[model samples]
Target: MSSLFTPLTLGSITIPNRIGMSALTRNRSTGTVPNEIMLKYYVQRAKGGAGLIGLNGPNVLGFGIKFRSKAGGKLPTLSMKLEVKFMLSFGIVSLTLIPVFLRPIIMLAAGVPVYAPSAIAAQGGRFRLLPGEPGYVTPTEIADPTPLIAQFKQAAINAKEAGFDGVEFHGANGYLVHQFLDSTSNHRTDQWGGSPENRARFALETLKELIAVWGPDVSLKLSPAGGYNDMGMPLQDTIDTFGYLLREVDNMGLSYVALVRFDEEDDGPRGTAHDVVETFRPFLTKTALFVNSSVTPAEGEELVKSGKAAGVFMGMNWLTHPDVARRIKEGKELDNAPDFKSFYGRGRC
Candidate 1:
């Protein structure tokens, strides 16, 4: 039998199969609320036999209150009255003061302008935002990280209320989380910047908040070698930051760490995703590791059997093959290829 079909446990949650779904954004949201289309899309994957599914965005740069529908459902909209009540129930102060009191720690200090780890801006002309879709802007450097931290905590609350089995913090692909980790991007002199350990601080703190609310089952997705958003850290820095980040995560007793691997010649992580996994797999004393990105089923099974990874995830393939797990188990052929035009919900009938 395929090892992909074997049961596995990630932190407190046990999944029936080793094959799960990766977060892929389907631009089907209406405003910041998930519409009926996304509901059907995920339901189909679950019924087709996905053990788990990760939705994207709620980028912390936007203070967690800002919604980005790049690869996940819109955070369910709760009315202001309900939001305030929810905060009160948790013993938190009124929602209105969240920004005022929870502002980034650095931003509140004297002589510090609000900025990111570095003052670098995100590159443009990559992809156009849809109508009503918020445009991507360069993040301001932060003096006060507390507000962003609170936003992340709120995102955790939103996720729990959304009834997901787990949530993967989108720290990869030049998003806000990755911005803090990249040296070229995070050029601050304070505690949140400089050195591998300092750069990893934001990611670690965010993990703590997530684990506090979501339990230990939270997964952090990372792409250390990623060059998106003009993000490309020195190779050794990438290695050191991720190595330290994994150890911190392992100590936190989190469910797992998901890696976005690339090919041998790919520039995302110095080497291929496989090499990245091999590099950091040893430091993970207690944490499960999940590998994804262009991984074939046979290769995934090998990674599991070899004990390098607990499971494998497929993102793009699952779009056309909802029954991908079953097909891999039976060695059946996959469905037709996904149309590139259909990915953005553009140029389609």
Candidate 2:
């Protein structure tokens, strides 16, 4: 039997198949709402055979780009409302929001400054930052975790209103939650920074708030040794920090914990350590765990069989091959050779 086609339970929800779509940011939202193009794109993927679709929360505010309607601006709003409702009715998508990243996008949309855990700058050119420029604008340092915690809680409540089956907090990728987890990025003297428990305070508190509103259906994504967006914590510190995090969330009964780690053989900084997923798998005693990377169908099956991951997540593959699950199931070749120029919004594809 193909592990990819097997059913898996995520918290109280049972996914029809283990093949799920990882969140993909297409930069196609109107400011805070998904456009018709975005709707069509996801609908295609759903029809193509994905069991679960994780919609990228474009900004921290949980708003996408503003809806630009051709029919007096009402069409896009109506389209999005209908689309979200329709997708939920299909019972196959998880809407997610990344705290710091989405907050920056929200602030930018409102013509205001963005904020993070600390004032540290991002490695240039990752998103919109120049080689030597800060990746964010007027990045405010979060001294108190109260306001942000409330904001995230409210966001979770709002997501429930939007008909999302679940919400995933983007704790990976050097966002606010991640910045707190990384000792080097968080240089505060408050309870939110400094020691491991202190650094973990913001995330745990915020997650607690979210759970209050959203319960066990909420999920978290993490990159234990994240180097993206100018993140570089001590390797040992990274392991220890994430170890603590997994243990804390273990009994929370979260829907799932998604780890974005390197493949088995990649020699990146975190790659040299033990497999992040396998090393941390024991900590997730109750929570469902999955890993996302350039994993092949064969490798995914092995990971599931070896009790490493409950399932696997695919990203870019879904971009070009919307029916990636079906293709993998049938042993058919995938068609996702994306043109780099088009991918970077520099081409007329």
- Top candidate, metric lDDT: 2
- Candidate 1 similarity to native, TM-score: 0.78
Q: Give the per-residue lDDT of model 1 (tens digit) for 187-243.
A: 888898888888888888988898898787677888765665456766677788888
Residue 164, candidate 2: alpha-carbon lDDT: 61
Model 1: residues with Cα > 4 Å off, grouped in runs? 57-115, 127-138, 263-274, 347-349
Name the best candidate (by TM-score): 2
lDDT of 1 at 282: 85
Positional deviation of 128 in candidate 2, in angstroms? 7.7
lDDT string, candidate 2, 74-163, tens digits:
332432433321111011011112234444444434544446667665544333322442244436675566887777777676556665
Q: What's model 2's TM-score?
A: 0.81
Scored by lDDT, model 1 comes in at: 0.63
